[model samples]
Every structure is written in C-alpha cells, then in structure tokens.
Target: MTTSSSSSATHGRSPAGLDVSASFATTLHTPEHIRIAEELGFKRAWLYDTPQQSPDVWMTLALAAERTHRIGLGPGVLVPALRHPMVNASGAAALERLAPGRVAVAFGTGYTGRRAMGQQPVSWAYMTRYVTAFRALLRGETVEWEGSPMRMLHTPEYPRGAPDTIPVYIAAIGPKGTAIAESLGDGVFIMGIDGVSEEVTKKFESVVYGTAGSVLGDGEDLGSERLRTAAGPALAQLFHISYELGGEEAVKALPGGLEWLAVVQETPEAERHLAVHHGHLLRLNDADTAAWNAGGNTLVGHTLTGTAGDVLARVKDLAAQGVTEITYQPAGDIRRELEAFADAVGLRR
Candidate 1:
C-alpha cells in the first residue's frame, strides 16, 4: 500500500508502499503493462521525463491512469525548470480529473538530462517557494505577490482546476534538498544507490520539519511523513534496490559500464552520474548491448553487484529503517523481474 492508502495515522504509525517506474520509453504498451504491474502486487506506478530519449512523464501517467484502477500514479521527480509551472499545474489537474483521487506529484532538481542541455539547476530557495506556491494553486487558491495576481488558464471547452486535495511529494537529494523537504512539511521522496544516511535524513527533517512547531495548517501530516516514517515496512526497495544489487549482469547492461568502473576508482562523482545515465540507457533498452558494454559511458555504481538474495535482504533491511516507498528500475523483462522480486520479498497477500 502507498501513503495514499496507508490509513495508519489513526493508530500513530506511518503507512508504506512501492513505486514501480522507468523513465525511458514513451509508450511501453502501458495500458497492458500497468495492469500487469497492478496484478503483480506493485503498490503504485511512477513515470519519469527528460528532454530526449525518455517518455514524457506526466503524459504517460495520464494514459496509465486510464488503465489501472486500484494502483496510484504520479511523476517520480519531474524537474520544475523543465517547463513552466503552469504546464505541471495544468497537467496534474487534468490527470486528477481523469483518475480522480489517484494523482500525486513529485518535484526534483533534475540530475542529468537538463544539465546535458546546458540548463542551470533551479535554486532550492526558489524551488521551495515555487512548490509552496504551486501547491496552493493546485488547491483552488488564487496566488498573488508583489501586486501581480496569477491563476491558471482555464476554459469552458476544456475546463480543469487543480484538485483541492492532491498529495505533493518532494524528491529531495543531498543534505540541502532534504532539509528543504522537511522544512516544507510534506512527503519527502528520496532514493540513492548508496543509501542516503539516516543522520542526514534526520538532520534534514530537523531543519525543514522542525522550523515550525506545528504541522503547517490542516490536512497535512508534517511530523510523520517528512522522514519516511512508515510503520512496519520491511522491504520498501524490492523495486529500486534491484538496480544496485543486480551485480555483474546489471553492470554489463550499462552504457559505459567499464568507463564508470574506472571513473569511480578515481572519484565517486562519476558513480553517481553512472547510476543516472546507465539507468536511463538500460531501462530504455534502446542502446545496442555490444556498444554499451564496449563504450566508456555506462552506469556502474548504481549496481548492487551482489547475489539476488543479498539484494532482497538489503531492501528488507532498509525498510526496517522506515522506508514506505521503493521505486525500482527492472533489468530484464518487466513481468519476470517482478515475479522474482515478489518471491524474494514474499509480497503476496
């Protein structure tokens, strides 16, 4: 189950769920695939977006919403700078209209594609302000600042408004971004091949979440959700964790697997990009395998490089740390990998 369906606040515990996603491929037989995903016991479906080589995240999600009923849907981390906030605001509103009560949005600072295009990163302070403002707009509130009034464009022919009650998840990486997530007092979405340390997670919440003593207004659970406080979850990463632990076969799937191995030897920054780049390369499955392995651009550090059982156990261990949502990028055929995952994690009812 996802935080949306958790229902644990009444009992003083957090709820947990999994996020199944891939950022590449515009259309993955989505109508059929998402249904398969729902049947496989996946909690929710997450989509990703980039300038080139990847499908439009929100567009794919709106399409997927028509296919699945019980599962949830949203962008894993749509970078705000990619387009006008109105684009995101409008797209989200429309998706909610179609899927009613099943839409959520996650915003992140984008790691790879945007930088590849010569775009500068959006400032955290600006993002914090923009997200705060964006949420309000999505809630049917008109926003105005410095004598300028702004409201989303609407029309009778194609009328839509932001859902009054859509959940907002923030993809906060690194210490700074994480702190912003906590201070804002909303769901914090984070996943790193190398687990983002608990101390950092705690420090992040202390600043972002602790800044204000009260849960900012009503209908928001500031204290519980900000720090992945899902109660009783023991294998949140059966999905995302698959990438890191897949080991040799996983590494062999990268764009420049050998190159990344060398880069990480000198400094770990390359490993981080390797995870992002190689994930895109393999998940899309567009690059030739022979070229990818021989080339020097593969993503290697993201690989778990361990036995399947160890990978599954690591995911379980992390869930013990309070992760509620695990977003995984599968290595082989989607259907087969999910089955292997469920068997390893015992995810059946």
Candidate 2:
C-alpha cells in the first residue's frame, strides 16, 4: 500500500493543521463522485489532469460546483508547462467565479503522463515562476512575464473584481519539490507509496503548513495549514481495496510491477519510485495494481480506506496539524464510501 510522508513524519516535524484532498474520476460517473464527496463532508474536491483518461479539468470542477455547496473545489493538478500561465490564470479565475471562496487550483510540473501529450517536465524554478504569475493574473492583476500560449473556451463569468484570486496550490513530491511548495505555493498535495514515510511528510507539512500564512499572507483558511498533510497511504490502501483487491494484480497497476519487487528488496537506495513499484508489487498482484497513479494526496491520503474510525483518526490527526480544509474526491464507492465517512465523521448531513 502507498503512504504519505505526513504520516511518516515524526511528531516533532508534523505540522499544525491538516486539510482534506480528493480527485475527479476520469469516467462519466465522476460528477456523481463529486456529489458524494460533498455529501460526505469533504471540503475540497479535485479534478485531475491526465491527458489520455481524465476528463476536462475546469469543466469537471464546474460540473461539481453546480452539484454541491459548502465544499471547496479545483483541479487535482494541471501541468504548469502544458498550458500557458494565462490559460491557467483564466481557468482558475473562472473556477473562482463558479465556487467563489470555494475555489483553489493546484499545479504539478510535467510528470511521466504529461509526456504522452509531448509535454516536457518543467524545472522547479520555472514551475514556481509560472504558478506565481498565474496566481497574480487570477487575482485580476497584471503580470510582467510572458508564459506559454493557452486558451480557455469555457471561461467562468467574471465576478468583476470579486477578489478573483483563488488559492493556487501545487502538487509536489520529494524534497526538491517540497521545498518548491514551501517556497512558492499556498499549499501542497503530496503523493506517496508504502516506503515513503508519513513521518517524513508530516515533518515537511509542519513546516510548510505552518509558514503558509507568513509566506502567502492572511486568510488562515486559505493559508498553508489549509493545505494537505501528505499523500500515499490511502492509495496504498486502495490497492488493498475491494474492487482493486490487494494482490499481484494491484502491484502491476503501479509503476514497478515485478521489477519493483526484485530491485527494492535488493537495493534500499534504489530509486524511490522503483522501490515503491517493487513494494506495491510485493504487497499486491498485477491484476489489481493500478496502471495509473496520480492524485493530489486526495485519493490516497484522505479518502478510501479502513473503517470509519480509521478515517476519522486520520482526518483528526491532520486537522490537529492545522489543516482547516479537506477536499474529498470519492475514488472508491460513491454511495457506500461517502455514506460511511459521513456517518463516521458526522460532518455530512
């Protein structure tokens, strides 16, 4: 199973707040999942940015807004390099208009998946620069830098200076990426597999979430603590879930497959993802292993897991760390998953 550095982090390093995170499904049923997240009391719902299988990011988040209230939403993460900052700015502003204070956008530097679209991975500095500029433009401010070319066909009706600046978060993992998040983002959505420790993440979370305010300025609810605690555990658990089941099948769905098992066991210092692939492979079978692994700590860290008590425990733990919001994306069961979480958390009515 996958786990986040937040959980792996030591108590000394754990942050002051914790927020929830979730993702949009790629299928037609996604809207339904959004509704379920709302009903389940998950405060944040995320729409993903996969080129091949994912749905339109802004449209999906907009669809979600129409269906629910009291829940904040945004794209799980759009690649900063793929679309120009202007387009990203416009889309984010549009989303803010739709959900107002409930809107926040997260970006990721190009990942393995973005390459499918002929997009190259972006440097951390560039990603930071692009996102900072995008946030500025979204707030209805003028920016000096020129970003890549982009266009948004379905723009949100401008609120005409309704504080159009929606919070912009980045989905980053690893030390270099985390440093970027701490430096450049309002918050971060961390990803993980079994080997990565929650303690490692929580230590980072404590620092970032704690400093979100001084860095971003004002809006505690919109500050760093409102950011996520970490990612990975939930996805690992998903591998152990019902539909996917926990076996060799699930292992193959992840990155390494058999290669992970052979390498990770042999090499501790081997590439982390390679180790994760192996750990996942060892923990599960191929049929159940997810071929795709992407999310803003939403699918893996906060949603889809053990008992209601287990979820409550996880949520509370993060909350204690100062996470004021928890965006829930129901990647698991729409009805049962939400129902169980709502029952356990008592946040859902």
Give TM per candidate: 0.66, 0.60
Candidate 2 local lDDT, 1-349, one digit each (tens): 1124343222111122344444544456667686676555454566667645555777777777777656667776788766777766766666666666677777777553354343446788888788777766655566767544333333354343343456656666667787787777766664322123354355444321210000111332211221221113234434333212344565445443444334333534323333333222112223223321222123333233444555566656656654444444333334554454455555543
Question: What are the per-residue Cα lDDT tens digits for candidate 1 across 1-349?
Answer: 2234553222111122223232222355554566666676655566666655566777788778777676667776678778766678888898887777767677777644554343446789878877877777776668773357678667777767447677777777667777787766357776453364666544432111100011111232322221111110111122222333574355445444544344333435434433334434234222222223344112221333233465455555555554545555443344554454444444543
Model 1 / residue 344 / CA error / Å? 1.8
Off by over 4 Å in 2: 1-21, 115-120, 144-164, 192-256, 259-304, 319-329
Candidate 1 local distance difference test against the native: 0.51
Go through the candidates in order and give the C-alpha RMSD of each one to the true structure.
12.2, 12.9
Q: What is the lDDT of residue 202 in candidate 1?
A: 46
Top lDDT prediction, candidate number: 1
Per candidate, the number of residue pairs that clash is: 14, 57
- Per-residue lDDT, model 2, residue 165, is 50
